[model samples]
Target: MASPRFLLLFTTLSLTVSSAISGSVVEDLANLQPPSDFNTTIMKNCQHNPSLRYCNSSSMDLKEIFKFTIVASHLCNESKNPNCVHSFDHIDLRNRPKMAPLYLSYSFFWKYCPLTVLSIDLSNISLKGSFPKEVICCDQIQALDLSLNGLTGEFPIESFAPLTNLTFLNLSYNYFSESKISDSQFFKRFNDSSFIHSGILPSDRNYTIKAILLLVGFPISVILMAVCFGWLCFQRPDYLPRMFQRKHKFTPSMLRAATNGFSRKNQMVRSEGVEIYKGTLRDSTQVRIEIYRGCISREKRKEFVEECKVLVELCHKNLVQVLGWCRTRNQRAIVTEWTDGETIEMWLSGSAPPWKQRLKILIGVVDGMRYLQENWPEVVYDLRINSVLLADNHEPILSRFQVGDQYSNNKKIHKFGIFLLEIITNRRSQEFERGEAGLIEHVRDNYPENLHKVIDARMKLPENMFDQAKHGIELGLMCTDQSISKHPSLNQISHMINKVYESCLELAPQNHKRSHGDGVVGKDSSNGESRL
Candidate 1:
């Protein structure tokens, strides 16, 4: 004979116990390790939940889900099921801030399952705290989305590097500053529309118009302008010729003092198109003066000067600053800001800085390319590694725009992808060693692995970073596919690079150490001692 109150409490307790017991598919799974098959039971029970939209339990294996977004309600693992594995690719854990702890726990699951793509688009979730570095361990992850979250910290470039498999990444709609990772043409293939709020049209739309303009309007304009200008010049030879003949005169004495009298030893750099000499004015300001000869026609020389003038008006961290230019008999000289660092190629060959410095250099290259592609639409052209030069601050600035075809067509975007792969792998595009006939045959015979070997040997890359690099190489291969139609757009390529970078960052190690060494050149030992 129990009292009424005690009877009611007992019944309620019984009902709660029964409900907890009945709700879980697995009664005892707490001790099992990850990659467990018990995930099938949980999936089966929670399949109807809206949040688990991307996950399917019919296959009885978590690996079935690939490149999907998962949003589920009432996701639970019984304390007994320790071996459960949750494998959802490109998951969006939005509208569920209360599930933060569960999301954090899934990162460990990511390590065990090695997802190839993951997106935690927690937009409007107002999530806090820094991302755990362990997320970088997902070596297979190729894409990551953590955008629209309240994440705070420096741009986690190092963390993202490990996710070499990543091809699309988004950290947009956050409160980040210059510490934000610099852009690369590699990232141009991906979607960047959500990052900046400028109210501009999508890149795809702009690219279409530019392509039409370049392919149709530009050629016509060039021919029409050339004819009109040529006719006008012929009629008014005195006026135009006099303007061109106004020689920028400099005294022989002044030239000698500016360049130490053209001493060969004083020349800082020599290239096919230009020779750069280090100089100092009477005021003691150091300068770099580049001399160009034999490349431009007399008529084209004026155009070149105008182009330089336009370039001088443009100022950016990625572009080298031009101080002034002069045209003398049989020669044209342009003064520019001197960069302290060496070329990226030199650094890759172990001729200059250490590996950590090289990573920073890569970031700089990305920044410069982003600037060029984003700002100077008319000059958008194919770029290569040789165009990337390290500055005095070891920052990378892009030059040598004169080379490569400039076309507004989206097809040119693939070239940027190839360059991105080159940077990560530290391999020359033309220099790749092929099997049988040549490099192409070799690459065709053994892709991915052969490509992986192209990575710089100076530093040990994390697994995820290596995977991201591998994915990038694959993307490059796709871009260079014999069938041009298979190639992706620059926006797509950018998205891919961003994804890889984000995945790498998520899985990067916590105790990883990087070297910081002096910027001076070492003796050119036959064994990796030359200055890059």
Candidate 2:
């Protein structure tokens, strides 16, 4: 053949041209436009019955970007599509080297498609190189399932910042050598479901490191190199107010004493993410101190403080009061007024609270929820029965205001109303095993003639209260309507309850009457005898 240099040049040019052609093919596949008839066919055959035709259509061009159009909420696994059991609408190949070309094609589709969920279970997928820094642009993605992937790199905090709407992020079973993310930052942005596969230790290493640096390195560095800086700061103390200062005023010794030297016996309650203890201040005011032991970042601590301030400012006779808070080197604690009453579960399951008292408890809880929804600024407390705390008077107080960012969307107002309905009806929203038939189905399935059978059996529903209960039930059903637009606001709900309450008052007999022997009462009017 030709000269050695010429031959080498020819081979290199050939390989470059071949690679370009291959890349072009993948790009074309990703950018393929849907056929004009595609929408018509999808709407006719799959729109209403997405579960049936989503991933089962053999005729559809599954390799092309247009294939993602088949995804719909109804197409979720509950539909029982044999071919599409594990079928996903989007596959992310971020930081994947061997799959770089595939990732490029995927990026094309990801940018074009309206995907809500992305499943990239690349757990064992060999990623020989470091993670791609530019792969953080998938902003609309709600679920990022990347567990079990061979991702050998430091935890990517910046990569996750763009995924603000992510509800589920599974990074378990991956090779992460260093822990750089804070627990508070983690919990504030993502829920517990976000880290299902990742092996997370109980103690947050990130927070510990920051605490050490603040307590040791920063102080020494300031003293050694910034003498004038310290003097100027000390002289112009008015520049920083005492309340606004970042000083660690609460000592570990004081906290230990307040918590009875960390006695397990004194622990009032312990949940997965938090712990509560009965504490006494110097004033001897009893306080229920709750320590949030979850992962949260320093940057997000200010937001958490603002949220806590809003909660503390809330004033209502039926609501629990937040007394004060303590922020130390290692932790954050919220102190609230103590309540000694048993939980609703205890009163209903136990033998202490009587039937009439139980009815009053229910009324008190509903009233508390009503007040919060109406009065609280930019916050809605979806109080579950698990969060209901009882006072010494046996009155229920709604507590624990934890909800995802979905609560802030105006579109979800109607959905919140439906949740309230579930509380009143005492039924779970997702009653069906495979799929949720919703609150309406649950109510219709369990309607009772006696009203007491459907209501809390622990309480006696007044005979004259049947109509009012029905009104309440009807309001609940209306709020939980399938269409989100149809549900009433909390203000509307308050008006409805008030109107019903007024009607009940007008219907009540003026004078009390009793039956001859059983002590049961009935109103003896000229018109007819009404049961009390």
Candidate 3:
């Protein structure tokens, strides 16, 4: 007849009372048995029969987080000096620092440092910002759990390579920016849930099986592939797309001739070991030949071809078109249509245009990026100003479409938000050797109150558009979150941009009416309405 809570409480009290009563009866028997017995002995044991209770020579290690909290050292034998591990192979400070009245703040608990064969648990201890560097110090640690904390930063495999004996690891619920355990074989032993919400995915492809299949079926596949290729050329060419046709594959010799022996005058370094050379093909079509300083392995040659096909096939008005590709054993290059337009970065470097012009260009970039999100399989990483080009016609051309939810957060959207700030403020992040700290950090520290300071003096956002710009700045701040899951969707971003832009459209007509002297166009100060 009792409620569930009352019944549960009643059962717990009854069990406790029964156990206490049983323990006292055994204690009574042990008192009549051995007078030299240990205190609180549960079993009826003679002092000589130490097997039934705790003993120094026992092989079993009693593990209780509260009780076993320190590391101890002692002589191995009477003949040997100290510096020997007499402690258990566990260093669990799991939620202990705050509850250290019993054991004086860990003692560091690593006295003789017998941490080699260790099982550590430091979860739920409010570890924020980054994981403690001291973890890698125990090179042979077998078990570690750092879950339910704010530990972040690069938790890559190589960083944990010293922990060769690490059979168990848990790093869930952290904000790590560069943990690449996903799609890796080395981390396959750990549970996938341990990395859930942290964005570390499990290895889907078994390379061992893949290698075996490649070895056994490669020769047969090659012949079958040729037949399929021929069949596609004769019939269903859609199966083997025109982008994959041999005509787009330019030889190294042709590319070298086009680039005038990789002339420095025509060359621009995109990144380390990568050069973009402006060249004219035999057909007189100008091209941007970007070559990497490496050789393509035979295994990756087919992948390279597939990559080239994808690059050339993605045709969008805003996207820079990849015309063809150049490949050889010692050389590899992608040939995209050459553009006379400058990057958004270059425009800002000199003198950025009015707010209207910059906003229009960003809108084009948004549309291009949206299309890429729908079609491109790759995750877009580097969506910077230098990558977003403006053509001769002043229309935005997203030259670097390398390849998000929400209106939720990821790097591409975050960078796009950063791009918005860049355009609005006429200021680039410290990334361009032009600011203190990150642009996002600067904005977060002082925004809305210091909105005037952040706005570009040169931009002169129309008095009517000022409110819209502020709204956009707020949207950009949200989108730049480190957790991409927090970012708003492309549709949401597009709407905000359009909303601001629509205000521009509305003001344009009013401005034209005023310019035409439409009967003394002015605001009625008392009524706060337009007067004409």
Candidate 4:
């Protein structure tokens, strides 16, 4: 509204004043300095920490200095952030040349930026290394927003411990393994989300510990398994499969020592390729060692061992017990429990025993055959008078355990008839001339008329047993019949003998835990001959 001359003069004055003000703002910003109480530690430590070493140079830029001033003023009492609790507004603090008044206002904050920056919102800035060391150095921080930094390592509890005034801390989305801060340092205002992934749980640290344990424990487990396998193979071959199940487990060297190296003096009997020797064990138990001299191949040795397995299982009072077995490169040997007294064949060579004693021997022989045929009918044995060994009490024991499947029960029973005749008649079957009938045929042809004449002249039978003797002679003839079907089964023979001899034979304990019977016919009741 004034005249043109007046308006032009006012505009010139205004331009001069504005230029002076703009010059003052530029001068003030250029010469800005932090106050005495400022946290210079943030810059000093950040300069030394590797991650924030660039902070020192970045802080020197005027534009960044302007941004830093805004950050400082955001927490001041004079100008607090409008939305500090949830999110922060983006601030464009680039160095543009227009606003001199805005520069003067920020210059005032640049004066106190170090002291007044109690709050920092550097969230989502991709800061690293267990959070920026710059923030930890600014220990006066109260509300820190370092979320989404992807920081890792041991949690900085010691560094955070000094930040006693910290209240609104957001360290979410950071991985940390340890937290040993004192309870006093964990103030009540801290929300659960403040440390959402921050403390007291496993991170990558457990993987390292597991790797070390595996390296040490794996070798120890393998060593233990090897030791157990070795023990099982050596000490317990029976528990293994049938192919690996060994027999002749006694070493030949041990048996040699027990037999005085097979001295001729120790030899008890010898025939064909077999020999029996008297041996004494280390435990002072007597053993009769029988050896096969020519059998040497693995097949032959296998046959010998297979025979031993059967012998070991056929335990009974009347059967001679196989104590152990052994084999060498060219020999197989079996050890048996040593029984005293000679075979029944040798006994008859001397003066004939009383008829009662001979009858007892006959009954025991029947019991032994009964057990053998009933349990192992397919088994083979030499059922001859010569095979009957006498115990100390003259109880008859069959000498041969089964070795193969060659002899049949019917054939063995027919031979048993010949054995009974030898015992009663006291005559050797081989002594009869070949042109004449043998003892079996002789006894079969003659009847009760020849029974007393064929009976041993030295034997004197009791009057009550005369009829029993007659029946026994008739039974022997029946056993020798030519037809195999005519032979009595061992069970029938046992029952017939038990019926005829029940009044005379008493029971006595036999082999332990064997099922042949509860006991054997060990005692003769007729005359105090309790150990027949």
lDDT, residue 319, candidate 4 = 82
Candidate 1, residue 258: the lDDT equals 74
Question: 1-532, model 2: which lDDT tens digit per residue?
Answer: 1122221112222232233333344453455445555445444444433433233445654334243332211122222333222333445444444644344334533333333334433444454344534335546566665565556666666667777777766665555545544634765665444444343424445545555677799889878757755543443322345664333233344456777886897698888878888876545777677887655677666666666667777677678886555554457777678888766655455564433353455467657666765666465564544567878777678665532343643434444444444444454555555322455665656664544545543333455555566666666566556655556765666566666655555554432332234534456577576654
Ranking by TM-score, best first?
A: 3, 4, 2, 1
Candidate 1 lDDT, tens digit per residue, 130-160?
Answer: 6545556554566665566766655555566
lDDT of 3 at 384: 71
Worst 10 residues of 4 by lDDT: 1-10
Give the TM-scores of the predictions, in the order they appear.
0.43, 0.44, 0.49, 0.48
- Residue-wise lDDT of candidate 4 within 1-532, one digit each (tens)? 1122211112222233233333344453455444432335335434444243224453444344433433333322123335322222222221222331253245333332343246766566555565445455555567777676667777655567777777787776666556554542553467555665554333324534454566787898899877866664565443457576455366665677778888998898899999999988666878899888884788877877777877877777778888778767778888888998788888877757766677778778888777777777655777777778988888888877766657677677777777777777777778877511477667765677767777776655443455566777777777777765768877787777667665434211222222255333245678754231
Name the lDDT of candidate 1: 0.51
Candidate 3 global lDDT: 0.61
| Candidate 4 pairs with clashing backbones | none
lDDT of each: 0.51, 0.52, 0.61, 0.61
Q: Locate the minimum summed-lDDT window of 10 residues in model 1.
A: 66-75
Worst 10-residue lDDT window for candidate 2 reads 1-10
Please say which candidate is ahead in lDDT: 1 or 2.
2
